[model samples]
Target: MARAFQLAGLLRLRQIEKDHAASDLAAANAFRRDAGERQARAIAALHAVPVEATDASTLFAMAAARASSRSMLADLAALADQADAEVAEAQTAFGEAKARAVGLEKLEARHNASVLAGELSAEQAAIDEIATGAWVREREGNEA
Candidate 1:
């Protein structure tokens, strides 16, 4: 019988960690995209604001609107930066998990190969012993 991999549990845990890291990376990328979109919208809104100042009140309102849009854009930029950092961290984690899993898999493959070679060697030895027994019986009959 083939022996079970000694690090099977560790391999499973590493696989789970890799999956979680992948999920986190995807989420982080989505958040970054969303923040970028919001920033673009804020910029567009700021640009669309009418510059025509028919009176003092309209001019003051335009100034306030521009100020709010700029503030929102700055906040979104910060969010985007944070999201980018998260993605980088997740990618690093995924890479490490993948490397660990690959290492364990290689070890398991090597162990399995060794087991198979041992079984084959045993079978060959048994066949050789049977052939020798048959040869000895034939020689004894001839001598008689």
Candidate 2:
């Protein structure tokens, strides 16, 4: 029973670790897509103007590029923070899983030892019964 509980706990902890890893991967992928989009937008703004045109359109485009770059930087910072948090959480969950697995292994070893001890005791009892029966049969033959 104790072994069963430990195994159950280990499985539960491993599941949690898997979930945390999935979430971490998703967040990283989202961040990558966000960076790609920001780069594409910036490139588009840069390509909007000819080299000789010094007009408001060109200035606005440059400003827009700067703003987009800054926004992307801010977004990346936020994503980094979120990713860090996820990594910490996943690490914690993995540690928990490792601990649970170790505990389950110990519990199983203990249960096996107990089973072996009981078997030995039962074998001893059987041997004593057989010896007594054999002795009784020999004495009956002698009396005859």
Question: CA RMSD for every model?
Answer: 2.6, 6.0
Residues 2-95, model 1: lDDT tens digits? 7787888988888898888888888888988888888888788777867899999998998898788778888888998998898898889889
TM-score winner: 1
lDDT of 2 by residue, 69-107 (tens): 678767766766666666666666656666756666677
Q: How many clashes show up per model?
A: 0, 0
Q: Candidate 2 — which pairs collide?
A: none
CA-lDDT, candidates in order? 0.86, 0.68
Candidate 1, residue 139: Cα displacement in angstroms equals 7.6
Please identify model 2 stretches exceeding 4 Å from their true place: 1-56, 135-144
